[model samples]
Target: MMLSLALVCDHALIDQAGKLSVLGIFERIWVERFPAVHPRLHLVLRLKGRRTEIGDHPVTIVLHDPSGREILRGDGMVQIGEPPAGVTEVEAAAILVFDVPLETAGAYHFNVTVDSELLASLPVTVSQMPAPHPTPEGN
Candidate 1:
């Protein structure tokens, strides 16, 4: 299998009809105050299965802090169907939601795995960036 796409977004919504809608797509988290809840994070992944692959598979998503400590985890199943004639691979999409762990500002990693094999890692940064000072208007 190959990871075609992996991303971290603010929100990943799956409708009853199996439609996915994402919002607030971002790669950085800026907290103005200390010890604040980091809120939500959405893991979006797309994988391509080999033509010979066909079955139900488990997909795991793991998040780690800058120190390489695991912070959050999510799991879901993906059904891979046999590819059409002459096709090499088929694609399957998975979306997992996680409330980001509240901690000090630093870089984080969102990892996607299938069948115990790591597919991709998406990096996100959470920093307590200071507010920019306003310049004088009459300058």
Candidate 2:
């Protein structure tokens, strides 16, 4: 029930037009466990940035299996807004949700991209079911 995120900032580059500047990249990975009856896997993604219109940009999520094979991919637009003052970090924010089959358990990789450019990659492990308890009678 915990979502772990890894934020990486590449070398900053000044835009030629001076309109915007590239600061850093952020990535997160987490495992979600649902009730046994739940039919799918839900992945929630949240991005936070400053002076960036997350809604105006395109965000994509690519899912890969253990062997680095792509299994599923999805894209969507985010709703961007300004963050409170004094927040030198990313001000805008975006959230993405991906649903997949729960039966699919293994090492999965996620690649996040913007404008066809690779931003970040994340790997996660999913477990199928909890181990059963043994009875004293050995039945």
Candidate 3:
């Protein structure tokens, strides 16, 4: 199986017709201070496989901090079905929601694995938002 798309976004939706809609796609997060909790974020992944690989595959998502320490781990499964007669590849998609906790400003990573093998590594950078300076009393 191959990872066709791996991204961080605000939302991801799949319609009734198997269409994907992603919004607020981003790679960086700005916070006002350290030890910030990003409320919500989505890790979207799209995988493609051959028709012969039709089955349930174990999926793992691991989040690592800037110092290479494991922060969070999520496990799930994806079911692959037979492709259409004219299509040779099957597709699977998943949206993993996370309330990311950032301890300090640096680069974070989300490592995606399928069936015990690493498929993709997605990076998200967190930086401190600049604080506003004090206004002068007299101009």
- Which is the leading candidate under TM-score? 3
Clashing pairs counted in every model: 0, 5, 0
Cα lDDT of model 1 by residue, 1-139, tens digit: 7788788787776688656787778889888876667755677877788877778778888888889999888787898887769998787777776667657788888888888899888889888978889999996
Model 1 vs. true fold: TM: 0.79
lDDT tens string, model 3, 101-134?
8999999999999989999999999999999998
User: Measured by TM-score, how close is model 2 to the native structure?
Assistant: 0.50
On TM-score, the stronger of 2 and 3 is 3
Please list the C-alpha lDDT of all candidates, in the order they appear.
0.80, 0.51, 0.93
Per-residue lDDT, model 3, residue 109, is 95
Q: Name the weakest run of 10 consecutive residues (lDDT summed) in model 1.
A: 33-42
Q: Model 1, which residues run further than 4 Å from truth? A: 13-22, 83-86, 131-139
Model 2, range 12-112, lDDT digits (tens) per residue? Answer: 33245423333434232233453212223344344555554434667688878667777778887655555567654442333343454333556667787
Worst 10 residues of 2 by lDDT: 1-10
Residue pairs with backbone atoms closer than 3 Å in model 3 (clashes): none
List where candidate 2 sits over 4 angstroms from the true fold. Answer: 1-40, 50-55, 79-90, 102-105, 128-134
RMSD of each: 3.3, 11.4, 1.3
